[model samples]
Target: MVAAMVKSARKPARRRLSPAEKARIEEIFHRFLSEEDDPRTELNYDSPYTLVVAVALSAQATDVSVNKATARLFEVAHTPQDMLALGEEGLIPYIASIGLYRTKAKNVIAAAKIIMEQHGGEVPLDRAALQALPGVGRKTASVVLNELRIEPAIAVDTHVFRVSHRLKLAFGKTPDQVEAELMAVVPEPYLVRAHHWLILHGRYTCVARRPKCDQCLIADLCPSRGTGARVPAVPEPERHRR
Candidate 1:
């Protein structure tokens, strides 16, 4: 197929994952499991519909801010029908604090209408159908699918992107390339939760400005560990719970 040919033309520039590397990867995840067995998205949503809307609203906003806004928004417009009733103008006031709230309000209303008319008010679980809705991109769909256990996916946000590189789990330049590499190399059992672990790690420990290498449990294995890294400490799990 031409698609296969095109795929092959763009070779995986990163080095192959050898057996030793595979074991190393597993060990890294094992440590993560010891720390936090289950990790969920911080965004508060009761159903698939709310999850989609919440994720779309989360763009250029923190989970805390999204949650703060959605607490009131969801009370009135949690479903496609409810959202349609509220309309774009009605939606803006709820999310005014969030960045790009006006544009997001439009997208949310448009997506809700599409869901109501085309899909009979049910949020599409599949990728293509979800992406067809306004403001619902690949990352949003991936998060929805993975969180619901519909698929094993890694939605590489800024945190995931940085942590992947710092840990040397992936070396790809772009998010898509990094995602492909992570899907290929991350062990199957850990595949689903791997997205959350990396994101949480990057968010709390492997930070951008100056990574808290001293507190990172996987500091010893991280290739990007800064010089003079301290012994890994048992960082309180409660702080990273969100």
Candidate 2:
């Protein structure tokens, strides 16, 4: 017995950047684009359907962990039909290592059934359709669409949000606001891969605990750049490779 409130909450509109700020933002992405001509998601997937499931499972979980689990999971059930055949019980063991395996397993199973019964086993590319899936949400659908290059979207995960704020690219209190700000401010040409660039920057350079300002390509342009931050003393990549 609950009464609906007459007043509803509304999120503020995306931030508006001044001409100078806009130019700085453009320069920031220019550096990113030059460094990595084409950036892609770290999550491994063979097709759109696999990507949908991978993204769904990645909520509250790391991509590395998801990839490790999916390495074996996808071997047996890459398609919606295959996933349906696996059943929820059979699916649990493969993803048991993930953070919320039990609930994720159920959602995966339910999503599979919906995809098979409603969408003819093909993962729908439409935003509304994708979000309607059991495990799929706004951010997950955005990731799928953006990664596949079917849509230009900035899914404001933790990395993207933190990097956007750190770089002064966005001043948003929530993922939706940050996403809107990015969608509006980012140059159209780089919109598709901006999500990846921000994510990579945050994950490796502008890390949470202690950002490596020295390694950031756009440090000169970053308004939030920490002058006191020191370079991480981690070993160089491929330094000890055979």
Candidate 3:
């Protein structure tokens, strides 16, 4: 069929990145580290327990929105014991604004109960332990580990996926593959902070729909320069509101 021929033609055009391209990607990463603050997760949590809860609530939701929801939730329930005592019903109103609230509420309550019973009411630092809990995955575990200063982890969220591929830093088809590629290629010194830097960059500059290429710090290093269609500049008043 004509469609099959076109699909085959498109495949070879997605070039495999070369070694020099990989090195340039590292330079771009260093540039970000030098200019940006020591990056941290946007989710606001006072302790590991609260962090687990916040990340659980953050699925399919924005950190800004999750933080707003959890500000009061954390104030009331900072520990697993506090959360369990609050119970699923009581917790509902606090996290109601987030998506999948009922399911998240149930999982959170179950995980909190397990934390209190099995881990001395503290969030476990190990990846396996964290992943065993409800609503926690590799990405969530990586976020927690990085935030808590655990080393050699790179959590590939939406931002990291987009930015890494566009920059030819990691040509992965899935989040797992991207994480593995980044872990192998990114220097050990940059591993812990890389997630935050890429995330912040993707969120603010190399966005999925409308990349701000003119203002991007690593624009020169990016390989997908013309792939993103040009967008009209926003008026000053509209920009300020955003």
Candidate 4:
């Protein structure tokens, strides 16, 4: 009777989803994979060299701007040797409209030189090697790797980070933490495509400032629902793939 009284005195635990609710989350990605015919980077590139330069220039810029710049830029310099020939001055003209074009130009030429001299004009497949390139960071390397399908990696950009937290799929303070949380929870089969799906979703549907929660297919499942709900810690079982 005393034990029963103690149990009664303590507040009941907050409600959480059943296993079926978790399964529903997994199904959401499956639906995304099925819907998106070609889940890949929007940035256009003819070669890995071009992809690297494009991604590097993409910082603080839109894919559209990068594509606009690269269309002419790649035509003239599709390879590292070609890019080096253009030098920073010539590269600037092509990318002048892009944000941070001056710094991007310098890095592009520098990276091109390194690629030509170090990797023999080929973009290194290894993450460390890729990150070693001028202006390349973990996110850029992750994007390159994911696009190549050489590894399953999620590049948590602004959109991805916002969407992940908003959906209560993750509650990380940084991109690395969010990526890890996403990788842990997202099913293995969908790992490769999840990166693109989350990015596109965040870009179009779950946008910043005003998320289209009504249009969001997974809105019902979303804990935050664009209204900043007090999200509970994700359960361990929910963190691992089924």
Candidate 5:
């Protein structure tokens, strides 16, 4: 019983991709670039302040839903001063359609006040400064940075996280670990738009419930193609041609 208990306590070995497999992953991203040259976030914002607020409000909310609210909200409150003027009570009505509008309203108002007083009414581009805001976290900060082109980062939202595990690009249990793994493997040139491509792919194609593997461009290279045997990675020349 003691030996059995000890054996049961041992963790299973993790799968590590080889150089060829890693290159194949890079090639998959290359294919994405070939298809969509300049991928971007779906959220619409006119300025850094609005973008920051939009991303913050987007937590537990859909971009479409957020955009709907922001379309009207931004018309009235595009700047930190404008948002501050709106106040928490005033802001709630604008974002009431969102999941946690009340809490989001409070955070947005507080963050806006901070930006106004501390950052001179501008959204700070730095990650540390952005995360210091009331509602902003690692993922939100990463999104703001990536969208603004202030930095190259992979923000592991549900879409990116699911796609990463589905493609066997990273076997991390958490978003932060998956992000580090991706940054290590993803080639330099493709880093800027990689997150956008992966997010779009997961949202539309590699869906959580039932991925459309048949229509997936990199289906041949995916280890989790839902088939038992591993499919061969498509050659670079052929991949670009498609």
Candidate 6:
């Protein structure tokens, strides 16, 4: 038991950024948005209910993977009533490909019941009401709200947390703290789409193991740009070829 406790207390290694590094990160984010189109989530959802369900299933999963599962799931059940009727047992096959399908399906069903019985079969627009639903947290609510074009909110996921720290956008140790810092600092215009931008950047370019730095538009503003980082480098053929 003691050995297990000691092992549990040992935290995984993580990267840290300095003040200069943080400044450079913000600069990169700003510069990237300056020339590019507004950012959006890759997950395809037609309504608020679909967006919330997609986000819930997205924990510790990929957007592409979630999208694949939801593509079929949404077809059969787009609303709370439809989802509740489908039931956890029935919903499993639709989303079974995802990481935690059983639990996600259970939560989705329960939340759907609540939405139908309590909220009159409509997705609530307020954060508090949204949070009261099963498996729905601030990050999930933020995603729904932002997608619905409501108030500006920052949803901190794995990509957001990794990218934010690496770029020094928000240095807090936890996702919640990082989210709060981002909300306080990021300009209003950028807040709603900021989560999407960061998630996409981290997903395709500033990746976890091997970021594609050479193709990154904001590499000039990154402190880790040329630190011999393990990130993937532009292929020699592609470099001059481009």
Alpha-carbon RMSD to native, per candidate: 7.1, 9.1, 10.3, 11.6, 11.5, 10.9
On a 0 to 1 TM-score scale, where does candidate 1 land against the true structure?
Answer: 0.87
Give one digit per residue, the lDDT tens place, for model 1 in 77-173: 9899999999999999999999889999999999999999999999988888998999988788878887876777788777787788777787776
Q: Give each model's whole-structure lDDT.
A: 0.80, 0.80, 0.76, 0.76, 0.79, 0.72
Error of 2 at 30 (Å): 0.8
**Evaluation by lDDT, superior candidate among 2 and 3:** 2
- Model 6 TM-score, all chains together: 0.80
Model 6 lDDT at residue 169: 64
Q: Which consecutive 10 residues in model 6 have the weakest lDDT in total?
A: 233-242
Clash pairs, candidate 6, are none
Per-residue CA lDDT of candidate 3, range 1-242, in tens? 32332222112213345788657867887898888758888888888888878877887788988999999998888889998999999999999998889999999999998898999988888888998998787777777877777544667777777778877667667766677777666655676678888888888998878798889888888777757843333322212100
For model 5, what is the alpha-carbon lDDT of residue 228? 41
- Tell me which of candidates 4 and 5 scores higher on TM-score: 5
Residue 82 deviation, candidate 5, in Å? 0.6
User: 24-130 in candidate 2: lDDT tens per residue?
Assistant: 98898899999998999999998999999988888878889999999999999989999999999999999999988999999999999999999998999978899
Question: Highest lDDT among the candidates is held by which one?
Answer: 1
Best-to-worst ranking by lDDT: 1, 2, 5, 4, 3, 6
Per-model TM against the reference: 0.87, 0.87, 0.85, 0.84, 0.86, 0.80
Model 2 local distance difference test score: 0.80
For candidate 2, the per-residue lDDT at 17 reads: 74
- For model 3 the local lDDT of residue 190 reads 72
Kindly give the number of clashing pairs for every candidate.
0, 0, 0, 0, 0, 0
**Candidate with more favorable, higher TM-score: 3 or 5:** 5
Residues 1-242 of candidate 5 have per-residue lDDT tens digits of 32332232113233566889868988899899988998888888989888988888888778999999999999999999998888999999999999879899999999989998999998898888999999998778878887776677778777787788878777677666678788766766777788899999989998767888999999988888975433233232211000
Q: Roughly what TM-score does model 4 have, to 2 decimal places?
A: 0.84
